[model samples]
Target: MAEFSNSNTVIVAAGENLPLTETAVKAPACIVHREGSGLVTLRGLTSGQCRARFKVSFGGNIAIPTGGTVGPISVALAVGGEPLTSATAIVTPAAVENYFNVFVAAFIEVPRGCCVTVAVKNTSTQAVSIANSNLIVERVA
Candidate 1:
């Protein structure tokens, strides 16, 4: 007999500060695992701090319940490759000087072979661009 195992995270892209309303904007599928540990790190470079908007939404048209740690969303901002935070809000790609850091922790339960969509938006009026962003998923031994 053979044991079974699986896990993965798809890289999503947002072009030219645009809203992802097209079929091409669909994010890759994430494998579902009964148990595992993982983390996702998003890094985008810009001229200054911009209020970067990001969301971890359910794959496809399926809607997940809100107000739960699972599938929760987060945002982080950095300036000159350094971190900065305000009393109430952290800096973001939208807020150049305030670069914010947001983490959702291990709060989501992804079904095997299923993918979660992570969308990042630049809400600032200034011209800002996304440099690099990546996601990772791992299975614990």
Candidate 2:
């Protein structure tokens, strides 16, 4: 695995303000998963310190961490988009006004013709939004 910094520069919706209840960080269509056996990692950040909630869905079996980091870490799992399991992570403190990273790491085991997806929820009562993030997929045999 390559080492990476948990820095994020998100371009949130223009008209929206901070302290959002929950927002979706829509991924590019090209980044979707395909049938295979490997690991998929999603990394992102919030504008401020908040609790991040994540969900991962796979047609087969996948193992993921239940807890994440404020700057960058992996998300947990969910059936579709709703969290099948819950996890929490903190972001940069509100005073700093810095973007915090969120990540979802999974070791996927697929039978055949299966797929996976990752989604996130800003669990902070103060409302949070994502601007931009990156997805890294590593194949392991």
Candidate 3:
């Protein structure tokens, strides 16, 4: 299992995407973690013999525009820059609340040498001030 986190001080503006910039746990070379990109690559897995489970999360206060309706802010796992829509979480901020947390988890199997990348995308309309974040990847089979 491997883990990564951020400085808890990164602010994500609307229409901007940023990667969490810290590697807290060092795993096997097959894990292939990239610095600053926040992308963890899992390779060398034989089909039907290996399964990887990963989760990504971020928590903070959201700033919603005044008089504007709530919008869906989504977080998902991206494999090679393509997001897996089936495993995603969306959170909408209302005027009654300011703090929010978004996360998504997926268990998947890949063929040998297939590069799988992981990151978080704030697919929403509100600006987020991320206070803390984490990503954990583990091999299940």
Question: TM-scores for all candidates?
Answer: 0.23, 0.36, 0.72
Candidate 1 stretches greater than 4 Å from native: 1-89, 92-106, 111-116, 120-127, 139-141
Per-residue alpha-carbon lDDT of candidate 1 for residues 64-141, written as tens digits (9 for 90 to 100):
112212221222222222222321111233222222233321222333333342223322323332222222222221
lDDT of 1: 0.24
TM-score of 1: 0.23
Which candidate tops TM-score?
Answer: 3
- By lDDT, the best candidate is 3
- Each candidate: RMSD to true structure? 18.2, 14.9, 3.8
Query: Quick one: ranking by TM-score, best first?
Result: 3, 2, 1
TM-score of candidate 2 on Cα atoms, chains taken together: 0.36
Residue 20 error for model 3, in Å? 2.4
Please give, for residues 74-125, the per-residue lDDT of candidate 2 as tens digits.
Answer: 2233223434343334445333234444555544333233444433333333
lDDT scores in order? 0.24, 0.31, 0.60
Candidate 3 C-alpha lDDT tens digits along 14-127: 544556577788766657766776567776555454444434333333434344456665555666666678755666766623557665677756556565666665555655
lDDT of 3 at 140: 62
